[model samples]
Target chain A: MATTRKSARTTPAAERPHPDATRRSQRSRQAIYAAALALVGEVGYPKTTIEGIAARAGVGKQTIYRWWSSKAEVLLEAFLDLGEQAVHAQGQEAPYAIPDTGDIAADLKAVLRATVDQLYDPRFEAPSRALAAEGLVNEQLGREFVAKLLEPSLQLHVDRLRAAQAAGQVRPEIDPRIALELFVSPLAQRWLQHTAPVSYAYTDTLVDYALHGLAPR
Target chain B: MATTRKSARTTPAAERPHPDATRRSQRSRQAIYAAALALVGEVGYPKTTIEGIAARAGVGKQTIYRWWSSKAEVLLEAFLDLGEQAVHAQGQEAPYAIPDTGDIAADLKAVLRATVDQLYDPRFEAPSRALAAEGLVNEQLGREFVAKLLEPSLQLHVDRLRAAQAAGQVRPEIDPRIALELFVSPLAQRWLQHTAPVSYAYTDTLVDYALHGLAPR
Candidate 1:
């Protein structure tokens, strides 16, 4: 449901004749997204309501209800927007996907290093953690977050790994879904659980250890 | 700090003369732990007060303060106690450590399989998930959880991997700490995030992938 939402506005939308009204609508949507993220981060999921988001965004309650059915939908779209903004801020093009550079190790390491930076970005950290914490207990919201947000990014890794397999980089027998977790989950656990520090060198080592067995080659 | 507190009392404490008083104290403590776990599981971390736990446990508020400093401390000890109970319920002896069966793959797989069982156990699942969710947002609580509960278990994996390294089963330069995550964190992420289903077969595959390179040998 969230995937189909056009989170990023294009020049074509701005190119519409009633430019003032379009700009006003865009401003209201951005304010609502920011307010939703901030409120969720501050008070957490259970306490955050559409009324709170509307008040925080300086819009009427009807404005939020007009756009989203629930606080979960609002937060989901807010997160998706945050991700796209983070990507654009990094000077990457819209619709970020894992690079398939032919050298699987180099490709994975580069993407993970980019991920390390994204994880550290203050804009992305607090609100994302807030939603994730809520998702741990709330089954419906958790599944929605996974389907709309996480699974899409993970599927990019699957695609990259499949490309690697075709190129004889990865073993054909490997399941890319499970295989991607070797490097991804460790960084995730560290970030989510505060288990350890993450760094470029650390992620680099993960790629190496994963591509080459821990057991002596 | 939490590690030093002996969670499981042995016969020596039970063997002391004043056996009726000792039995009563033990029963009260068990009731308190049960109350803490249940309350956290139901209401979540922020709202679970010591007074509330006492009310649920049918003990005075003073009884709780007499033993622990804060709700975090109580929950920590409660989790530690829960872990010990799970181990005992598995019919394993006290000081539950991973078995070092000389075969590194087999040893790791066995431990992970046991972990799969533990994750599925209803007694462990709800409270543990609740606490983990709290840890994601609560920095101090999260760090304490890592230092006391998580790191000790991870250290056991490190010890076993170091043994493997010594035996030339793992490469000499391999950092046992990071290597363990290639398998461990995946299971943890799946459980914590509900990112996917976890099963013995899934974990068994993780072990096989980690031990053998995803790349062609």
Candidate 2:
């Protein structure tokens, strides 16, 4: 989400500008992220501690403390990094923004299809679910993660919808914030609650139904 | 919810055939439900135990096991009872079906407004969040609760959509299951994730948007 926070925490020691130090620091950070995700996924958010994460990552506890304030921060950054990795793996660049392909429907459908794949990705599923589960009851963490992680992504939708409105695709009077929910929240609930199965077809239908209305066109 | 399971578990011993036994049994059952809800709310799902609920309710462990198979079943029944009680408090009868006033939008809005109130209700909020949180990490429990506690309520929406379709209020080709999510899921995700604040106005907007579509009509 916030590039500044990630960069500030993840960057190598400013005093040690050596290339080898930077490489080692990058390896350690990646290890920390991996350990944090795996620990949270296996033991859940409540039981996962910084000590456990450091132990699992083969890093000193001081090293983890030096970079991040809490396990929550670590997990949050890990998830953000995981998202970036997923996008890069799909051959997209970092800070991936929604495509403005001049066709709102096609662009929205493409993003949602990608999201469906991400939701099903084994790498993303367990840790995400664990964190989400904790967020439900842990109100402070819930609000923090929503503000930092989820809201930034949701804002992208608002931006796209506003663009659509300017282009005469979406109604000018519609609230982009609420309009995005019509398509996004259903898939989220399905994934979070295991309420139903999700797929390209399901998300495509959501896009069409959102654009065309459930009532007569 | 499944009425048969509730009735079978909640009923007094069939062999007793005495009014006193039935009254005592009903009192014990209510006490157990209240205890289960309070305990789960206080300590969350993982830490809550049958012995703990039994002690809190001042009932024997055998009484709990005799009636229900596990804590999940107990909590599910308690929530079902809580919903029934909420409806009753609203001066509505049990088995509270969605109203079909022939104006599909109005009917959906009315139910959603009631749901917003229910979500805000203190009695339902904490325990419900705790159960939902646990359900996220625990697959079998999640599936079981969704099937028993959630799907039945969702089915009400499906049924209402089907009626609207029959009456030509909704398009014939719309899948009631998917169509219902347009309005239902957004509210659900908001409540579940603390993604945003929910209110009657927000839900009313959802109903309007889902019915009318986001594009220019």
Candidate 3:
């Protein structure tokens, strides 16, 4: 993965000054992103340095510093890029937005199921675990990752819930921020802490329980 | 805290014919626990050594090896002892049991609120964070801690939920294990990641949402 990224970075520089240069830059950027993710997964966050990432990507240290200020910044962007790639690989639109087919529960369940697949994917699992483990010990880095990489995704759910509320599907009194966690955090805890296996069925059940109270109706 | 625990440990020995024997033994044990918690919290799990702990405790290396086989065992027991002391200090029964007030929601909210207090308490915060952070990276220690410290407490919630189920309060089909996470994981995430502020209101909302569901009835 790192070698592929490094070679890809140089491809654009070899090309001419027109649209091909732009394409090469795009390819190099993607390569850097992939290298960052792969290296972090292999070495973990603390041991993953910009110098190592540059060495792995076959780029100068200046290339990484020019793009990202720190290792955390690189990883966050790398994760964001990975999410986009995952969406693209799924044959969805480039910047994957949650679909609202006028069925809020169905939309939420579908997204969570997709998330389970992403979490379980071998390519994403190890690096994400490393970054998450570091986040547990490093408060500032944890908060930054949550704000940049996590909160954006969570806000998408919040937006969906708000739309549900407007349609009279969700309770007006519900705090969508916390409401999203009803399903999200359970899956997150299971994945991060090795507390349980995450599956479409488990997340589906979570959505059902969150949408319908655990208590008898 | 170490002084108190050490004094308690030596009380039996002090009662012996040798008047100073009890005080000496108590001091040693207290020093060991304090040293263990501090070392683990400061340097983290893999780096913490029994010899290091003994040296810090002002005891011979054999002292720790005599009681515990590894640093993991010593740290685990130290945490258990700390929890017991925390509960005792709160005037609660040692090995604290969650209250059963028949109203499942109220009981759950109360317990979660107490948990919020404990998670934020300065004495418990740093050391627990250090261990939990290590658990994220070390699967063996993570599972052991979960089984020994977390699961027992989680089971009490399960037992309470079962009672609620029998009382026609909770839905009969609900799995208490997963159901518990709706309330528990949110707080755990906030504490673990510093994603958000945890409070009585937050926990109360979680209980209400977990019981009542987010959708309009």
Candidate 4:
């Protein structure tokens, strides 16, 4: 159910009527994000609530209500914020677009190795899995997550592959979108299904195999 | 949470005392399988219960208790039965072995196409997704399903790739186990995550990309 219960405000916070960057508001926003993420990780998506987040964040319920539209929206933005923090921790800029070193194989392999690390990172693992598990059954949320969170990252690979195609490192005929899945999906399945362990070595091999045909040249 | 409450009647049901092939027993078995699949598909894995399946199947709880120890076990067997039925309907032998058409690409492509069909099959899709989603968050059950259900199917791919290697169609150095994922996991991610549509063409493209590699030869 969409949480439209909040009485129509004189102004919706989504319009960002005021500059939202004040130190106090920033602290509260960070706390809310942390609270929402930790709650979802611990209790899962369905059990988590705005009350829980507000209490955990040491903020009033109205504060959260004023900032976000719904719990799902809160979590989605929280994950986005978390991803940004991770990229920052890596000393990278926002978006953390996949590298295009012009050595296509090395660039792809490097990014995938980083992905292996991210997939195993404890801070993100439980909540990401929880979100993913929910997404499997919840089609609308699944598609939203894919569109907002996943597809953007996937598109970076598409851009890298298109450059590779132009450089003649990749076949012009190959579809970059589908080609990226060759490596990405293997790591994803292994992580998602507990089918196997993921590692730099495994991802390195995937890049190798994806670029070089499995058959003897 | 393993169920060990059922008193062993000095004969484990796995060692069926009766042939269990009699028309009446077969009918009851089919009904039980149907009930288990239907219940889990509707209510999901955690909420599905032995009592529910038995009641729905028109069998006593003791009848179910006699056969399987837990709802998980019952659902597992029902899926296995369903898979077997699918194979039988294909006019194939018990294992639903991938074709060894002497052309590795054609054989792998053919198998993947069948897999795409199976992924889209309404009978398998919802229940499998439910079990799989649960498996993501439930480590023990996830590992159990992978070991028992998933690994066996993957081993078949390993076998096919091995034969292709023996014929020099695949590189001997290639590990068939990881090699198979190059095609299989893409289809799986698309189906599981709702990231994209599953079709014979998509699967066919996966097979081609996997075998030929994305790089120019």
Among the numbered candidates, top TM-score falls to: 2
- Report the Cα lDDT for residue A37, model 1: 89
Ten-residue region with minimum lDDT total, candidate 3 chain A: A9-18
Candidate with best DockQ: 1
The sequence of per-residue lDDT tens digits that candidate 3 reaches over residues B1-217 is 4666567755775463464765876778778988988987787766788889998999998877867788888888888888888888888863567777789989998899889988888767877888888787678988899889888888988988999999999999999999999999999998998888888999999999999999987
Q: What is the TM-score of chain A alone in each candidate?
A: 0.90, 0.92, 0.87, 0.89
Error of 1 at B6 (Å): 13
Q: Note the clash tally of each candidate.
A: 0, 0, 1, 0
Q: What CA RMSD would you report for each candidate?
A: 4.4, 3.9, 5.6, 5.4
Whole-model lDDT values for every prediction: 0.90, 0.92, 0.86, 0.87
Pick by TM-score: 2 or 3, better one: 2
Least well predicted 10-residue stretch by lDDT in candidate 1 chain A: A1-10
- Model 1 gets an lDDT of 0.90
What tens-digit string does per-residue lDDT give for candidate 2 at B46-71?
99999999999999999999889999
**Residue B22 in candidate 3 has what lDDT?**
55
Task: For all candidates, state DockQ relative to the true structure.
Answer: 0.84, 0.84, 0.74, 0.76
Candidate 3 lDDT tens digits, A1-217: 4666567756765452567766876777777888888988887788899898888888889978867799888888889888887988999873667888999889999999999999889889988888888887788999999998888898999899999999898999999999999999999999888887878889999999999999888
Off by over 4 Å in 1: A1-17, B1-17
Q: What lDDT would candidate 4 get against the real structure?
A: 0.87
Return the clash pairs for model 4, or none: none
